[model samples]
Target: MPLDPGTPAEAPTRTAELKVRGLTKSFGRAAPVFAGISFEVPHGASVALVGANGTGKSTLLRCCLGLIPADSGEVELLGQQTGALGQGARRRLRARTGMVAQSHNLVPRLSVLSNVQHGLLGSGAGPRYWSHALAPRRAREAAMAALEEVGMADLALRRADGLSGGQSQRVAIARALVHAPRFLIADEPTASLDPAAGEEVMALFFRLVRSEGVTVVFTSHNISHALGYGDRVLGLAGGRLAIDADAAALSERDLGALYG
Candidate 1:
């Protein structure tokens, strides 16, 4: 059985954080996307999950987030077993975590403030209503604070569809941060941006990790960028965790083997 967050002697010092053990996912009876993958991300650490396309990086993330069922494994979020959680339990679990995918899934017609306010809808504060009349003051304050953190507060009244790709991505990031999640998982956050934009986004992500003490796990294909941004790099190859090491400790040859 997976452990729960408590003062148990066996629990890690920071038990209220993310943990994955023996996680495996498969489409059918064939080989798994990943088998026996295990890793622990302590609170307030930034970890980069790196691998080539089709290596199951996104699959692993989806499984971890309970978006898809894992073939066999255990996932503990904040010390609770998430693999076996029911819908209600999963919903509550997700409330404490945030995700930013490559695609900024924003409502095109909605204003930036409206889009950011949607992040608070899952908190069960109340029923959903029209964006104009439903001025959730606390939620708006939090959303604006998050936007300020990402330097997008000035565009809060603008339509999401009118923003540039980078701006939209920043809004997405702001939405994720508005909830103050204990864990933030970003899947290829910079994949759609130019090099400079990617670096700016990455820098903002790291700044959040450092300033807010939030645990961050992000997926990236650019090895150099991953190395530059991540404290630790987890390399997935052939549906398995092939390499796990400090970014500074890895060499070009090591990265080559992991990719090849």
Candidate 2:
């Protein structure tokens, strides 16, 4: 089904944090994952990408962040045209962004503090940023602050593997926030957790992001989350953008069509 590519009425006046125009991607010998997809996310707006499984939500996020090259079209992030950046510049641009995924992506043997400190590695890599003991006092303090925001500071010294699923996600959120990214991208961030834990993590995550005024684009299979947490919702289906509408204007019934 074809859907309008328009944004919220106020979106056009605000500076766009992200803009995708006619973005397309495909793997060798396969149909396009999504073709001619387009949208704009106003600065500080929260967007939810939702679709049924295999709809390429994760791949689209990767393309938007320039983690993977697009087959065609434009992706502008932070007002910079991604296709125009060289490798070094692209890396530098990506440093200003944070990412969270379904998997916690923590180092099992590392202390929670150390894992959070690694978030600083994006700005620059060095021994001092890799371990809690090696990190400078300032970095350590910042990591703790991030952990405090997520209610994970008490587990600073615990090993990553020692935490429960919910605790691990809290630490993951801290790691993502430690660098104070201007934009955050999360792919199914709470998909692995039980409902109660997912609810807590989502609440904490959005509270922290809102307080910091960070723009967010996260994918989720949960329709309730898509509508409740996002300012706008984008839906992908049948190798195209099937829905783009204000989250407030949509109901679960409206979104259910995308699943078919």
User: Best lDDT goes to which candidate?
Assistant: 2
Residue 54 lDDT in candidate 2: 90
Worst 10 residues of 1 by lDDT: 124-133
Candidate 2: C-alpha lDDT: 0.92
Assess every candidate by TM-score.
0.90, 0.94
What digit string (tens of lDDT, one per residue) describes model 2 on residues 70-167? 99999999989999999889888988999999999999999999999988898876778888988889999999998988888898999999999999
Candidate that scores best on TM-score? 2
Badly placed stretches (over 4 Å) of model 1 are 1-16, 127-133
lDDT by residue for model 1 (57-113), tens: 888888888888887888888778987788888888888889999999999998898
Report the alpha-carbon TM-score of model 2 versus the true structure: 0.94
Candidate 1's C-alpha lDDT?
Answer: 0.83
Q: Report clash pairs, candidate 1.
A: none
Native-structure RMSD, model 1: 6.0
Tell me the whole-model lDDT of each prediction, alpha carbons only: 0.83, 0.92
